[model samples]
Target: MTADRQAVTQVLSGLAEIRPWYQDLYRHLHANPELSMAEYATAERIATELRNTPGADDAEITTGIGNTGVTAVLRNGDEPCVLIRADMDALPVREATGLGYASTATGTSPDGSSVPVMHACGHDSHVTCQLAAYRLLAAHRDTWSGTLIALFQPAEEAFDGAQTMADDNLADRIPKPDVALAQHVLPGAAGTVMISPGPIMAACDDMFITVHGKGGHGSAPHETVDPVVLTAAIVMRLQTIVSREVDPNDVAVITVGRMEAGTKNNIIPDTAEIELTVRTYDERVRTRTLDAIHRVVRAEALASGAPEPEIRFLSRLPLTTNDPAVTEQVRQAFTAHFGEDRTRPKEREAGSEDFGIIPDLFGTPYCYWCFGAHDPAGWYAAEAAGTAGSDFPDCHSPYFAPLLDALDTGVEAMVVAALAWLGTDRA
Candidate 1:
């Protein structure tokens, strides 16, 4: 075996000895989840773990960056730096997994709803894997020469944490990272990692449309302008934009997730509203899709003889693009550490990630890969049942669970990638 592979094997073996502790940490975070912008306890727990870590030095805890965000710095060398990020916030989903460590923690949302919070999106697992990788890198600092910035960010689900940190000049304050790396726990193909070269994730924009009309008695036929009809027409026409306007091969998705109009059956409402999410893989498509949406809404409303619709863009997330050269480097590192069988080319994902903002601002190379979360039983059952829709609960679902046993593999993969980038050893 090559020297680099030998070193990776040694690190993996060492990681095995401490896997139990990492699992415990994952369980702890899973059981006590926190919501976005309210991750005070979560941040404190992660900071404590980093402080207790063997190679952790000069750990700094800063709060209120993106509203309840925390960033911890770990340095081993004074050379060029790279940043590894892990999101720390959890969803306000009620636990339904019935696991022993299921979350019973409760929090009040900004909307004043009492909800049970859990790590249903697997942010807990992300944080745990990040800690494990940090420990391994620290233990083997002698093998590489560079700086490591381990960021524990908050509010990824809301998709504003990365941008908030960047706006505060987080990168310039620390060693400016030449490249940024992050990973998401996916619910597919256990024991495998998936990555793509560019535009791996889609840009997401939330749109709200309010349609105003004349409120009158239901008995009136021609006297009232019915916004419900106008809203319905708009939703139906919105789909045509994707099917007819956009190229079928381009992968643009426009979904109207919510619609509300009237509260009383006997009376026509004065206003109707619809909320939609627009997703696209390219900037040109993103702009065209949005502009088309507005045009369709206005034209439909005018045709229906109703008032103009009020359109608002609630929020947006940029597309995640992986630099081709950096992605090839990562693939080479994975091949050197693991066998050729363990590494495979990946396809584009329709989902969005806040990490995309880094590449938008600094023009730094960024890549976010998927870590498999299926167990043996889960994998077989899914395959046998032909229900492998999603191997684990989706990121925002209430039942999202991660396989802790596979974490060591993820840590080792990250270590190999980091070492390869530092040009310390080659197999």
Candidate 2:
């Protein structure tokens, strides 16, 4: 075996002892999920666990930096520092997995409605993996020669945690990371690790369009300007942005997620509104898509004799671009540790991660990998066998649940990646 591979194996072997603890923690967090910007208790629990772990006394916990986020520093050597991030916030999804540790925890949302909260997105497993990495790195500090910064971030579900932490100077507080790494649990072929070189996640932008027309009785067809009709026309035309305008090879998606209009059946409403989400990988394509949407909405409204439509673009999650050189380095490390067969090329994912925001501020190398969580014998047998949960719950579904057993490989992979980047002791 190669030196790095052997070293990684040694660290992974050491991690085996904590496998049960990782599962227990995963269950606890899964049973008590918290929402974005409301991860206070979650943060405290994580801090407490880290503080109690061996060699983690030097770990410094800073709370409330980015709303409800937690930042911990684990120092070992005097060499260059690296940052490893794991999101800690859960989704507002109701638990339907029917597991013993399923979340019964409920909270009043910003709208004041009670909703079941669960770690359906696998943040619990993410937390466990990060902690496992922290412990392994800390225990074997003698084998590595650099500082490791662990981020227990909140609000990743809403794509705001990384920005929140960055706004609070979390990056500046520590030595600007030489490399930034994170892992996402995916329900896919078991024991496979996937990575893409650049623009793994698309840029996500929310859109709102309002169409206005004169209100009149339904019977007076000629007297009333119909905005609902205009809105419908615009929606259909918006599809052309991707079909006709953008290159077929360049992926772009424009989806109208919602629409609202007149309430009464007998009258034409004065206004109608449409909500849309636009996703794209290339900047030029994104700009063209947005322009096409605006043009379609305005022209359709004008052609239908309606007032100028109002267009609003809300929160934008920038396209996540991984540095090529850094990505190659990670690929090489994964090949060294997991073998070339286990580490394969991954296609670009349509989803967006707020972690993309990190590269905007610093030049540090940043990449995220997919951690296998699917169980072959279905949920029951997988749970009974203590295998990793499948990607089945889907990301934002109410039934989202992750298999905690898969996190063992996640932790080991992260440690290997960190050590490889730091140029620590070769396997």
Candidate 3:
């Protein structure tokens, strides 16, 4: 390592040290989880933590930027500004993990429905680590140059907080960042960081398809067109889009998550609605997949002699692609700290992230990584038994629980990434 590299890593390692105090903060946030855009208490707590941290004076902060979002700004020297982000919303899943910190809290969802809340997605860890990273970077401002813009984004689960920040002029408020960085905790062995050069996460589209038909008694099959049968045909045909239409090499998924048609066995409803989530890494595949779905739904409805079906696209998330050179630099820096074994390369996942909004909107290059949130031995063992991730709790599950041991690696990785982007030259 060069003298400057050594000096920066040592100083940053010391600064990013996980303190005993963060445990309670993490647990408190986990226990009192809030839903997207409704993170009133969660937002307040994060803002309070940064405001009262030891080096609070160096950072100028704001709240309510994107409706319960908080951004803290810290400037060190003349180097290029670096943006670091963490999501701040919890999912509507009730806690089944049985941890002491598992959320019993229920909150209002975006649609104004009362739902149980839990940090099943591990946003709690993301927020806690960002708080730690920001405090340390601010405390040791003399170690590196450039500005630090840390955003505690709300509504990631609702799929729009990062975009909301952009709409509210997040990039214009602070000078646009030269490099953007964010990390997520996924179900894997602890202490490892998964990095991919381009298309780390899939592009996601949420849509709903409605099948129209005449309502009639179940006993009188000839009198009415059965919407339930039409719904079944549509669902089955959707399965062919990936296996038959899209190239085998291209990654894509079409999931029919929700289906509703009849309230009673004897009654054939007038309409059946199906909610779908589509994932793809390539735009062409995404387009072809969505188009195929529309065609299948429409053709099936028409063949059934039913009225025209309705299709509505709910949300679209851009694909997340890491900047090649920047990713390699961060990978090398992580390998130095985690060794070659822990800092391994990863492939593009079918999962999606609205977090990609940061780089897309700011026009800044970004690198996203997944840090494992489960014990290695158990995770591997679980995978062996035909279970999820070697038994690691999957995100968004009522039973999801992130291993706390990964927190330190996440904090340090963010610190190392920021230091690298901010450069090693000291003032």
Candidate 4:
């Protein structure tokens, strides 16, 4: 075996011993989730865990970054520095997995409404794996030499955590890393890794639109402009943008996730609201798509003799493009450690991430990868039966549940990837 592979194996030798602790941690986190930017208790728990770790006594721990983010830096020598990130926020999804440890927690959402919160996106697994990886690296310090920065970020579900960290002077607060690394638990065969060189995830843009109209009784629709009809027309026209305006070769998705209008059946509402999300891979395509939306909304309103609709941006996320050199190093390490069968190339995903913001802030290169947490048997069965889409529950779903076997895989993936930059010295 190569020196790097040997080093990785040595560092992970104690994984079996530490597995139980992290698995329990996963359950605890899974049952009690915190919403975006409100992860106060979660942040404290992470700091406490790092402090109590065997060899992490000297690690510098920082808390309350970006409201509720945490970072622990463990240094073995004056070698390369690698920053590994994991988000700690949960979504406003109620638990439906029916697991004994399923979340029954509730938190106030950004909209000031009480909503059930759950780790529907597998972030609980992300945190557990990261903590386990950090503990292993610390316990087996002789196997590698470098500064390892374990960052637990907050508010990722709101798509602003990375930016929030940067705005709070994350670079000045911690040692700048030569490269950044992050991983996500996805729906695939357990113990497998998914990686790509560039643009693994798309850019996201959300907009809230309000269409104005004159309100009147429902029975007298002829006397006033009907915003419901105008909005319907706008929605239909928006569909044509992808089919007619954008090139069929490029990828772009426009989803109208929310619409609000009249409250009573007998009264026509004065205005209608629409909230949509736009996903795109290319900057030009994003711009073109957004411009088309503005034009279409205005044109449809004008055609209906209604007032121009007001459009406001809800959130924006840049495309996640992995550095080729960084990705190759991690990919080779994964192949060497996990073997060819488990280390596989991943296709471009339409989902969006804000991780790019942090590396961009540090002006350094980075790579983010995914690992399978779904049951291998079930995933393969779905694939074989051509029912993968219908059979497998994806991230952000209340029913989304990652198998426990993936916890070890996630730790191994992070350690292997971090060691690619940290060191290859024998223990």
Model 4 Cα lDDT, one tens digit per residue, 1-427: 7778888888899999988899999999999999989888888989999899998899999998889989999988866999999999899999999999999999998779999999999999999999999998998888888899999999888899999999999989988889999999998889899999988899999999999998999999998899999999989899999999999899899999988899999888899999999999999999999999999999999999998889999999998989999999999999988999999898889989998998889888999999997888888898799987688899999999998898889999998998889876655
- TM-score of every candidate relative to the true structure: 0.90, 0.90, 0.88, 0.90
Candidate 1 at residue 63, lDDT?
52
Query: Scored by CA lDDT, what does every candidate get?
Result: 0.78, 0.79, 0.84, 0.92
Q: Provide backbone clash counts, one per model.
A: 0, 6, 3, 0
Q: Between 3 and 4, whose TM-score is larger?
A: 4
**What's the true lDDT of residue 194 in model 3?**
85
Pairs of residues clashing in candidate 3: 379-390, 382-390, 383-390
For candidate 3, what is the lDDT? 0.84
Tens-place lDDT per residue, model 2, 1-427, is 6656666666676777888887788778888789888888889888888788787788777778788777777776656777888898887777788888988898768898988788877888888888888888777666666678888888898888888888998766666778888888776545667887888889999998889998899999699898888888988898888989999899899999998999988889999999999999999999989888888898998899988989998778988877788778888988877788668677787888888676566778788888666663574365466663342556666665555557766887788778777646633
Per-residue CA lDDT of candidate 3, range 152-213, in tens? 89998888898888788776677688888999988877888888798888999999888889
Stretches of model 2 off by over 4 angstroms after superposition: 1-3, 6-10, 77-79, 221-224, 376-393, 397-400, 425-427
Q: What is every candidate's alpha-carbon RMSD to the true fold?
A: 2.7, 3.7, 3.1, 2.7
- lDDT string for model 1 (306-418, tens) is 88889998889988888888888788778766667656567777878898676556667867787667675776588689877655576677776666666766776677766
